[model samples]
Target: MDEQQRLAYWRANTALIRNLLIVWALVSLVFSILLVETLNKIQFFGVPFGFWMAQQGSILVFVVLIFIYAFQMDKLDQKYNNKK
Candidate 1:
């Protein structure tokens, strides 16, 4: 690819990674810690929202999001001939 294309690809990849990281961080820190008090008042599936988020929900979401990101990035890599 040309310099411009290379720059664009890197920018896009960086943005995607950054956004995902922010989302993961929010789910981990905000819902899990920062808002735990308010979240404790809510319930989901017979468990406190904060408890579920800290122990299970966030981890599950992170796992699913990471796999989705990996799959999408693999396709992006293939499109850009970045994959062997």
Candidate 2:
């Protein structure tokens, strides 16, 4: 790829990463800690939502985010002609 194409690809990749990181942080930190009191007022599958998030929900969200990131990055790669 040309220099411009490389730069574009890098920028796209960085943006994708940034978005995914934000989601991860929100799930792992905000849902599990900052919003725990409010979330605990609700129940999910018989467990407090905040407790679930602290124990398992964040993990599940992280896994899902990984998949989403991979899928989006694949599209970005194709868009930038950087696919392997």
Candidate 3:
């Protein structure tokens, strides 16, 4: 790829990472921690929503995010013609 293409690819990659990290932080920090008191009032599978999020939901979301990141990166690679 040319220098311009290289810059664009990096930019897209960085944006993807930023967006994913934002989602991770919101799930891990906001709903799980900051809003726990309020969220505890809600139910999820017979458990408190906040507790479920803190104990399992966050981990599940993180794992899902990993797959999403991989999938998105693959698309980005294809878009940038980075395949070997």
In terms of lDDT, the best-performing candidate is 3
> Which of the two candidates, 2 or 3, achieves a greater TM-score against the reference?
3
* Superior by lDDT: candidate 1 or candidate 3: 3
* Pairs in steric clash, model 2: none
Estimate, for each residue in 1-84, the C-alpha lDDT of model 1 and write its tens digit: 788877877887888889889999999999999998899999999999999999998989899888978987887787677755
TM-scores, one per candidate: 0.89, 0.91, 0.97
Local error of candidate 2 at 81, Å?
A: 2.1
Candidates 1 and 2 compared: the better one by lDDT is 2
**Judged by lDDT against the true structure, how good is candidate 1?**
0.88
User: Across residues 3-83, which tens digit of lDDT does each residue of candidate 2 receive?
Assistant: 999998899889889989999889988999999999999999999999999999999999999899889988887887784
lDDT of 3 by residue, 13-54 (tens): 999999999999999999999999999999999999999999
Q: What is the clash count for each candidate, in the order shown?
A: 0, 0, 0
Give the candidates in order of lDDT, highest first. 3, 2, 1
Candidate 3: minimum summed lDDT over ten consecutive residues — where?
75-84
Cα error of candidate 2 at position 33, Å: 1.0
User: Once superposed on the true structure, which residue ranges of model 1 sit more than 4 Å away at CA?
Assistant: none
Model 1 Cα displacement at 38 (Å)? Answer: 0.6
